[model samples]
Target: MTRRVYFDHSATTPVHPEVVEEMCRFLKDNFGNPTSLHYFGQKARKAVEEAREKVAAAIGANPAEIVFTSGGTEADNMAIHGVAYTNRNRGNHIITSAVEHHAVLNTVKALGKQGFTVTILPVDQYGMVSVEDVAAAITDKTILITIMHANNEVGTIMPIAEIGRLARERGILFHTDAVQSFGKIPVNVDELNVDLLTISGHKIYGPKGIGALYIRKGTRWRQTLFHGGAQERLRRAGTENTPGIIGLGKAAELAMANMEQEAAYLTRLRDRLIREVTEKISHVRLTGHPTKRLPNHASFCFEFIEGESMLLSLDLQGIAASSGSACTSGSLEPSHVLLAMGIPHEVAHGSIRITLGRDNTEEDIDYFLEVMPPIVERLRAMSPLDQETEFALSDRCNGCRVSHTCRV
Candidate 1:
């Protein structure tokens, strides 16, 4: 059997064994509704609170500030839309980056339809957004600024701390989609100066369908998508996914214990892959900030070939990689994140993202490096519209006809 190698950690990670063990115990032995007032309910409630505390400690936030949600998308939607609706009287303007995840971008777009004004700031060639641009976009009516902690597709880490400081000075609320950076990088809400942050469990090797949002104390917000009996401080309304929450807590604990070692290992593997691809492939361009990016993320674009083709070829070789965000994969359109970074349409369509994780090894990377060049070459040859040759198709046809003078 062919060995399957997964390089799409940015999309989601497999639940760790410890997380699964913790969750199974809660699911089977500790089954009870957290909202129930009976003994069974009390046991479940204790589990939820313990999980909450674990999540809070992971990010240096208080347990009271963490509001559990179904996942990162829900958390992001709640933070962005909640802020917009609740603070409408203060302002109708919201600022964000062009490269945010669809969760943030789509929510802001929906807000725009309902009389809210949105300003989308652009990034540079290296995929880094300028704090100055964010500051300049702010107005008296600007109620909130939402930027991603790190770009999902390109792995660019935004200067959230700098932007947070600016937002705080202006009394504008700040939120970040930290799904990509939270477990991979060390994050402290106080250190970043952010008003709110979003995290997804599956992205951090926890179970899917569980996530959390950190809302700073004193930030008043209305719940836009819930109806229940005062659970989650009335901010979020739903029966807690006790098993999933327990898994998340275990995952968070494990991450905190081994964050440094995991980072160092993944960084070494990521750098080696980058070096291998760049050296072996011609006309390939690396995306994102060279150094200030995720330890596990390595993104690049091979000019003149469609990203989808490259991804499929890798998949055939038993390697799973991504052409863009997992959310936008099946669509024909190029990645909005790549377009926002000012990459040309053709180049953006040629982009590929390879994210590493704890499960990867040096041998896996070496095997990928060995197989990648031939795949790129084969795809480039098969492409009818390759731009490598300077002459037009007609010019090349003329030469072919001359070489085979009377063949026809």
Candidate 2:
């Protein structure tokens, strides 16, 4: 049997054993509605508050500021739409990057249909958003600026602190979807100076269907996304996902304790993957920032082949990987992130994203290196794109803007 390896940690991670263990007690023993005033209810409520504190401490936030939601999408919507409606009288404009996850892009697009003006800032060839563009996009009517902390598809970390400072100076509320960066890197709400931030549980080795939005205590925001009994301090309305919340809290605790050490380990493996894959494969280009990217993320585009084909071939070899954001993978179109970074449509169609996690080892990377080169070569041979001649003449490399550094 082929050894199965998972290299799609950016899409989601397996729930940690400790997180599962921490949540089991809530499902069986403390199964009571947190809103009820009974003894069991009080016990559940206490557990919920404790979990809030754990998540808060992980991101330098106060417990009152943590509003639990179903997942990152809902948290993102709540932050953007909540602020849009709450502060409509103050402004009707939003500023965000062109490379944001669909969650932010779609939410802001929906707002645009409702009479709000939006400024979608462009990114450099390396997928880094320009802080100057952000500053220039802001206007007196710009009420919010929502950019991702680290891009899901390419793993480029944004200059969020600088952008946040600009937003602060301009008196604009700032929000960031930290789903990809929360556990993988250090994210302090104070240091980023963000007015609101979103985090998903599954991205951090916790249960799915659980996430949180951190709204600075004095930030002008309202909970208009849902209307129901006053749960989440009247911010999000639904019976709390008690078990998932417990799991998320446990995951956050574990991340806070081991993040630094784990980052170093993942970075080494990630760089090794990058070096081996680029050196072994021909007509390949690394996407995203070469260095200012996530420690665990390695992305590339191989010419003369499509991403879906490479993904399918890798799967048969018992490796789970991705062509782009899992949320957008169903689409046949090329990645918006790669396109935004000025990669041609043909090149962007061949992109692959390999994100590492705590469970990965050097042996796993070695296994991948052993299998990946042949796969790309096989695909290139079968392709009608005429790799040898076309690849030499096409100037696609020079057009990609990374040709000077790309090993190919």
Which candidate has the top score in TM-score?
A: 2
The TM-score values for the models, in the order shown, are 0.94, 0.96
Which window of ten consecutive residues has the lowest lDDT sum in model 1? 399-408
Q: Per-residue alpha-carbon lDDT of model 2 for 1-408, expressed as tens digits?
A: 999999999999999999999999999999999999999999999999999999999999999999999999999999999999999999899999999999999999999999999999999878889999998888889999999999999899999999999999999999999999999899999999899999999999999999999999899999987788999888899999999999999999999999999999999999999888877777777888888899999999888789999999999999999998999999999999988887778878899999999999999999999999899988977987654343343333532332443322
Candidate 2 TM-score, C-alpha based: 0.96
Tens digits of lDDT, candidate 1, 330-359: 989888877776666776788899999999
Q: Which RMSD values do the candidates have, in order?
A: 6.2, 2.2
Global lDDT for candidate 2?
0.91
Query: Global lDDT of each model?
Result: 0.87, 0.91
